[model samples]
Target: MPVREFSSSVPLWAKRIASAIYVERRRAGLTQAALASRAGVRQATVSQAENDPRSMRLDTLEKILASLDLTLASARRPH
Candidate 1:
């Protein structure tokens, strides 16, 4: 998959969620390696979630997020 940097122009929620994961991981004192080990995914997958392209499987993303006590939710855009 092609790699892309997250655009600062993107909405706050996107950046917030990403930042939350990083913050929480640090707060929980879990290294990316430890979280990946606990979540049964590769360390690279954890790195990808933090800094790589957004091309991982939804299920895998869900697994990683769930490991961090975060859940994906559906939302309606403001009209």
Candidate 2:
């Protein structure tokens, strides 16, 4: 799948996180229900995270990312 470019209106961090979750979930061939079950969250939560990651808590994001065998990494931005 092609990476989506969020407009300037959306926060860059939220867009990156949401896109990563969406791409990884699709790549893993797991439905929202399956992922949510593994993550110990509701299917709606998974859906919401993929659609609007900024609204999700850090722990919840971590759970979902872990379930998908993905990890969060940070890099310093060039100034």
Candidate 3:
């Protein structure tokens, strides 16, 4: 398998996204594994996103959010 290069530090935007995912995951009462299954992604993928979401792809994020009954539009709006 090829190696992936990640930033040493997480950016502000990534931190915001990670925070949102963590909070939403908790609110939905789903474990990382469960959310991964529902979103058709690996558990590690969810973990990485929750920890540092800078490298998270738009499609993957959309899948995760949709699995949690969320939309990019809703997420972008200030709550």
Candidate 4:
């Protein structure tokens, strides 16, 4: 609910990355707030990463990804 899965403005690649993060967070049974707490970031940062990662700092994204048991490299790979 924190992120829109797709949109006219969002690129396919970014969507894929965002989807990966969104799916993993759901799979891990975590809300954006919970993930933020675990990742030591703000809920807004998690939301931004899930919806539009371009604005997110790499370290913040890394923290969120790590909290989901993922790595930046894995998120970049095509599904």
* Candidate lDDT (C-alpha), each: 0.65, 0.75, 0.76, 0.83
Q: What is the lDDT of candidate 3?
A: 0.76
Q: In model 3, how large is the Cα lDDT of residue 15?
A: 59
The residue-by-residue lDDT of candidate 4 on 1-79, one tens digit each, is 4555567788776776787789899888999999999999999989988887876778888899999988887887664
Q: What's model 4's TM-score?
A: 0.83
Put down candidate 3 lDDT per residue, 1-79, tens digits, no spaces. 1222336687656655666677788888899999999999999999988787667899998898788777776654433
lDDT string for model 2 (14-70, tens) is: 676667777878888989899999999999998877766776788888898888776
lDDT, candidate 1, 1-79, per-residue tens: 1233467665555544455556566768999999898778998887776653256687887777788877655211110
Provide the lowest-lDDT 10-residue window in model 2.
70-79
Q: By the TM-score metric, which is better: model 3 or model 4?
A: 4
Best by TM-score: 4
TM-score, predicted candidate 1 vs. hidden true structure? 0.68
For candidate 4, give the lDDT: 0.83
How many clashes in each candidate?
0, 0, 0, 0
Clashing residue pairs in candidate 4 are none
Residue 79, candidate 3: C-alpha displacement in angstroms: 7.2
